[model samples]
Target chain A: MTYDWTLWIVFILIGLATTLPRGSFIILGERASLPEGLQKALRYAPAAALAAIVVPDVVLVGGVVEVLNPKLAAAFAAVLATQVSRNPWLPFIVGMGVLLGLRHFL
Target chain B: MSPSFREGAREGFRVFLPLSVGLIPWALVTGMTMGGVGFTPLQAMGMNVIVFAGTAQLGTLPLIAAGSPVWLIVVTAFVLNLRFIIFSAALARGFHGVPRAERWLAGHLLTDGVFATCLEKMLSHEDPRWRLGYYLAPSLWSWLLWQVFAFCGVMAAGSIPKSWSLEFMATIALIVLLVPMARLRPMLLAALTGGTLAVLLRGMPLRLGVIVAIIGGIAAGFAAERWQGAAR
Candidate 1:
């Protein structure tokens, strides 16, 4: 377990940054109207952010795109599962199940 | 203090309960990973309480382990959480009428799930007070569950074997949660674009690839929306 003064400083900085996003508008209250283009752009943030996190996890191996792997297989399977069943749990279950099965049996 | 508040709280909790199922695995993984990476229980708990952003926390852990400079770690966390800035701005409308202190507290507790749920509820409900309660209930619930599950993970760290591939399970959870959010064409475009580019640019240093992918996806979505508007 690593501990030092830097951890606390980094923690505080990240904490403040995290809070700023959630608190800024709420605190300002009356003076918060983003421009139309920016607003439209921001609407896409969630999907973009999620993709930014997920794609690399599945497709990239050690910073390089790997074509053959169980992780990629599971990611594709998850996408198909979502298409077949709108149930959110289905993709996760199917993907994890596929990954486990592939790892164990194949 | 009122019936509306009570009802709103209940509904908020109810709405959040389903979404939280997806996050539980990730929370556990976070705790396990924290412990695995040599973070003391105290550090893990502090991160769970203060940082509260899973993606950012996950991103920062590796850098911290690498003994990266404090500035770099801070930058990474900030960029990963940049989405929250947009979330907060969007949330302003929903929480416009709420008091200052509550609003600030709400911001501290805000998560992606709560923001989405609250936005949906705000669209459906006209009452401000109920909306506040609705938003607060789930935010608090999520915060509580995150802490509890993460603590459990830290405690059970060595007990859980690595071969379980728990890390992959967390990834699956994220994928499942994200795929549903792509119902609209613009959203679908954004996800595809971001996902594709993220893979293509995975080699980029400092995880800047994620930031690049996000910006590209947003731009692509914006273009698609504009084209659809023009066509319509």
Candidate 2:
């Protein structure tokens, strides 16, 4: 186990570094304008980051890409819900419902 | 809070409601994972309160468990959270003309979901109040819930059955968030490259793969946009 003091130090360091980047540009205010190209690239940041997170959760099992897990089906259901209803909440509901059912049956 | 700020907070909370469900499972799992690693409740909660980034905290837990040095742990978590720099820059644009103090607060509380919502509202020409309110409210909502669910996870550690598979909700949450953003060709390409690279690099340690994928996706998306512009 990490020493209590060591853990505290680590937490504080992590907190500072994480927040620094998050606040730096915002604090710069009107003094700085990110390049137009960079701003356009930032537009894709959400989609890219979210997909980076989602893919591993659904596709990987024991660090291997496996489609056998229930998450794959749930992902499909969620995507369909998003497409059909155009409601963000529906995908999570439908996905969870499908996951629960699949977990019970699979 | 000022009356307008209060109103903005309320609107932000309301808009974030849907995404909160997705956050619950992840927070619960994070708490439980902390407990599994023999962290005291105080330590666990302390980490959540201070290190507020869920992905970074979670990524670091495994390293801690393995007795990795403090430097390695810090570096890994830092890299994992590098995406927020991009978010902060983008948020600065969305929140242009806001007071410095308010912008500082927004920057501290920023998360990917809130940032995306704010960007969307800004791009659509919503009033400045709506934009600020929308961002602050959801960021607060998710932050509070993160603490609550994390504490719940610690208290109820090992109680949540694996069969519940609540963690999958995180992915589901991302799905809902990512889908709406994928309307554009560049967005789709970004998602494809990011998701594909993440899977391909899944074996990389310290969740470095996520950072790699994010960079790769952005590059692909940026190139795609430039190519389209040239053809036109």
lDDT (Cα, tens digit) per residue for candidate 1, span B96-152: 677888888888888888888788776577777888889888988888889999999
The per-residue C-alpha lDDT of model 2 at residue A17 equals 66
Q: Please, what are the lDDT tens digits per residue for candidate 2 over residues B1-232?
A: 5566667667667777886777776687678767666677899999998888877776667557757667766765665566677777666666776787887787778776777666666546445666677687788888899999999988886565655654455556557667777888888999999999989987688667777898899899999999999999
**Model 1 alpha-carbon miss at residue B94, Å:** 5.9
lDDT of 2 at A10: 85
List clash counts for every candidate, in order.
0, 1
TM-score for each of the candidates: 0.76, 0.65
Candidate 2 lDDT score relative to the true structure: 0.75
DockQ, all candidates in order: 0.53, 0.44
Candidate 2 has an interface RMSD (Å) of 4.6
Docking class of 2: acceptable
lDDT, model 1, position A96: 71
Compute the DockQ of candidate 2.
Answer: 0.44
Every candidate's lDDT: 0.77, 0.75
In Å, residue B221's CA in model 2 sits off its true spot by: 0.7
Per-residue CA lDDT of candidate 1, range A1-106, in tens? 4678678778888888677766777677658666778767877876786777677777767767787778889988988997888665577678878888888987
